[model samples]
Target: MDLYITEKPSVAEALAKYFNSTGANFKKEKNCYKDTKKNIFITWAVGHLLYQNPPEAYNPEWKNWKLDTLPMIPTIFKKTPYAAKKEQYKAVISLIKDATTIINVGDPDREGQVLIDELLPANKKVKRLLLNALDETSIRKALDDIKDNKAFSGLYAAGDCRSEIDWLLGMNLTRFFSLKAREGGYTTVMSVGRVKAPTLALIVNREAEITGFKTQKYYNIFAHLKINGVTVKASFVGDRITAKSEAEKIVTASKSSELKVTDVFKKSNKQEIKELYSLDTLQIDADKYFGLSADDTLKTIQKLYESKYLSYPRSDCKYLPTSQFTDSPNLIIAFNEAQLLDVKIPLPNLRPPVFNDAKVSAHHAIVPTGKIPDLSTLSKNEKDLYLLVLKKYASIFFPVYEYESHKVILTNGKYDFTFTTKITVNSGWTALYKNMPVSDDAEHEQDNEVEISTAVKAGTAYRVETFELKDAETKPPRRYTEGSLIKAMNNIKGDTKESNNILSKIKGIGTPATRATIIKELIAGEQLSKKGKTLIPTEKGKNLIAILPEIITKADYTANMEILLDQLEAGKIPKQKIITEVTDFLNTIIKQKDSLKIVNKDFPCPTCRKGFLMIKYYKDPDTNTVIEYAKCNNAECNQITPAKNNKPKIITCPVCKKGFMISKKNSKTKNIFYACSCYPDCKTVLSEDDFNKKRG
Candidate 1:
């Protein structure tokens, strides 16, 4: 039997459809689709079914975190089936064991290559299929041109090194900081990771800047002048004045009512359409236009890709390969037939800015599959995003935007004022968006308009009607939204000179595939919160950063590690070297863990009067709800008491007005229930449904 393993079930189904299209009789089976005549079997794994073994897997003593076992380095890392995905693993194993030949049809990336390659049996002959797009044509082409699986061995090695290193660092550091914080009387789990810590630091640092910012008052001097029956507004040439008296002096110094135009520079410029959508750019555009979070936009685009409405969504490249350009006319025809194109714009003979093979990696920029989608079937957000991608793709065929820029300098006594104006000579590419809704990107909007007549010459003199001094204040830096945060993560570079050049060349912090997961993990761990579109670090997040070493919190550290991984992927470095370096780093962190100090406020233990209480959080397994508590520090007395929920909650008990409703678990059954905090005395309990209705 010939077996094909894909990274996702959707991809498997798409490939199965392609095989069956040529009159190959294929039938869906228990865990795979079978084509008996062609002797082919297609199956998929639900992402990664296998993950690195937890710390406990190395040794039972590693299960309980203690300062003595601070650095638990596994001599030999092992792989095990993910607890939640064991069934899928078993099915895949069974299929692979029985197959005579195997084809690795995973996504075209390091992670994808490792995910399937690690599971293949060494006895079976293996081939690799690299698909840039999931459309029928692309799928068929890839199927016809499969390569040896060993071609991607370097990618697998890089991925393996990354996974093992992350596990080692995350396991040791999370326990180290968590226990250290506990020693300082903090009860919450201080979760830390290689990528997550630095990402959190970004938010925390921004918040600190916002908090410590002192607004400075400033003033601007504006002069209103009339030129050829048109009023032109000009501002003082230099920086804003810090003192009101200084601004007043400038206004007073301009005693001459008539101002002469000393210089006028006019030039025509052209602006090409914005680059095509990479996952980062698409996420940014989605957030700017529709207030969609990075996670939401990724999910939507992935769905569209799986549905065959768009190409791959996790691509980092923003340029199409030369091969894809060959199909541009067909794509345009499809768009026209689907009414996605307003005007039938002919494809330019010369190559546009969007085409370049040098910029294409793994996959090309995200574009439609030329498969017309049913608009009615798509959700509102999906339709919006599809249209957004379509418009960007169509823009390359349109003309370049042409505009004439004019800069004017006016002199009033000692003060020289400057004004600028722009006139659109031709809309060109921007004409496609004439009827489209305005984007939320502030940079997309034209600057302040200054009306000027055509008759006005460079040497012409105009009368200054009035001068106004405007008071302004320097604003604090804005907080990161999900979209901007992703961009920052993608663009972040090392701060130090040692790793600056290498880190600058590589993608920042996380890969396009993992960035969404990183943000989601931070949010799930209560390290970050979303208020509208802004991502704010929580107290827990801030505290984690406070206790971590500077090296762990800097993007440079992670960027340097990423560089090593890239080197491993390119075969420039050995996998064992990366592992050895990580192990050494871990040992150093463990040795220095004792010196780190965390200052946590202490509370007297209610259960044990002799011990100071530490704040700890307990997550209920059944309900997945986290409850904070005050835990006794004494090992002998080890008593836990529920901490008060001081944060504002919408739910309050009807029976006892003084107590709020909190989620509590049944000690014996381990079932979650909502009950009044007054417990034994008031004894008011409700189910989740009842609580929701009562709150309503």
Candidate 2:
């Protein structure tokens, strides 16, 4: 019997439907679909059914976090059943045991390779099917190219090492710093991560910069030259001038001397279509244009991909393979038939840069699979994102954006000024994106005021007609928006020409597949606060960074670690090589147990997600005894529950399975009663005695 293991249930359905199309009969069961005639079974694992075991699972002594057990190093990581998804694990395992041959239908990535490989028993016949898209054509293509599972051992090793290292460092470092913080008279427990720490640091450091920044006044000297009866305002770019007196000197000097056009340069340039969407780039664009959170944007991408409106939403590669050109004509025809664009697109015989250079990864870039869903049924955001990807793909067929850039260098022997302008030869590929939410073109922003006439002859003499001094204040760095933050995460090295030349080889902090998740995790752990569209670190987040070692906070350090992960994936180095490097680096920070520090922030209320814990001292003057307990800041949820296992005690409503049972005082009797957190909605109430009895 043959078994097919897919990544998720939706994929199994797609596969089952494809086989059914060929007149293969299938009987849908509880956990799997079976085609008895062909002796084929299709099953799925819900994301993942097994997770890495906790520290206590390895050693009992490592369970309790203390300074003595500062670094609980584990030589080998183990995987145990995730309690919530154990049934699926058992189902997959049971099927694997029964089958003679197993086909691994995981996503085409390192993580996906490891996910299915970990489930199979040794010596079983396993073939790999790298499924990029669920569309009929793609599924058929992937099915035809099945290879042996062992061919991806390095990819699996890289993925395993990534998880093990994360568990080792995340668990150990979080314990070490949290223990140190406990000694500092704080009840705060720091939740640290390998990627989360550096991401939080970015926010905290940016906030500090903004808070401490001081505005500085600066002066600009302008030399307006009159030539050919046209007056052109040119800023003096002779030399660095900060002082008002110095700017005055340049204005005076240029006023007394005749200015001549020393050089006139004109160059034609093309703004090619922006590259196709990588998952990270798509998230960035979605956030920039629609204020969608990274997590939400990713969900939308998945929805579109699963619906067959997109190819693969989690791709890291920007380039596509030449074979993807087979569907372009149909996709263009679909676009024109749907009336998506004003100008009807011809046959997509045009093979553009998307297929050129071909830096393809596990899958090609996210492109349409020549399928368009019913537009009216889609939500506004979904419709917007779907079209965004569709238009980006369509842009490749448009003409190259052509423009002429003109530069005029005016000099008075001692000082100089410059003017520049652009003449749009053709709108080209960008014509499709007019009034679109795409970012301003970099070349367009680099140019100055563009009213100058490029037809003027060079070396023409002109009088320095007028001089003006403009005052400006230097601006501080802006806060990181969700989009801008993702952009920064993609390139840890600065974006300037200077930094590009210096740090061009440096990799990003995280992969396109993991960057959004990192941001989402940081926000969920309360290390990052979202205000409007900007990201700000909370007080607790700031203190966590302060307590962390300088090496952990540096983006370049994390970026370099990514490069090592890549090297490990390529089988260039042993897994232990990267593990030892990370462990050694972690040990140095762990040794700083004595020096670490963090300020205590108000702890969240145990019951309600929105409230915080506040202490109230009830004093009896005669005995000098005070009844002290933390009260919730929220008036609605006034549950004064004791702490259990370091987290707030949760006494849930037995009837509705809502949140913790908040207490209410009976006005007549002065007795307490309990009600569900969803009180008005769920009118299940109980007396204090009844609640205590039920708890017991």
The C-alpha lDDT values of all candidates are 0.80, 0.76
Question: What residue pairs are clashing in model 1?
Answer: 187-615, 187-616
Where does candidate 1 stray beyond 4 Å?
A: 13-30, 83-88, 134-145, 212-214, 225-231, 253-256, 337-348, 374-378, 434-456, 496-498, 566-574, 601-642, 646-696
- Give the per-residue lDDT digits (tens) of candidate 2, residues 1-696: 999999888789989999899798877999999998789999999877789998888889988887787677787888997899999999999999999999998877877888898898888999999876555776788788889988888888878888888887789888887777665424556788767777787788889999999988888777776655566777787545679998887777666677788888988898887479888788878887788888888888788888878876777767776666776787788788898766665565557877743366666688776677788999988888887887788888888888887787888888878887666887777767776775632333542456444465687878777788988777778888777787887666533454343334433566676778888777776678889988999876888888787767766555455567778878898988988888888788877766665435466764666766544445768799764445665779765753332344457788888666777788999788877777688888888788777655
lDDT of each residue in 521-572, candidate 1, tens digit only: 9998878998988899987788788878788888888767777888888899
Model 2 C-alpha RMSD to native: 10.7
In candidate 2, where is summed lDDT lowest over 10 consecutive residues?
440-449
State the displacement of the C-alpha of residue 415, model 2, in Å, after optimal TM-score superposition: 6.1
Clashing pairs in 2: none
Evaluate model 2: give its TM-score: 0.75
TM-scores for all candidates? 0.81, 0.75
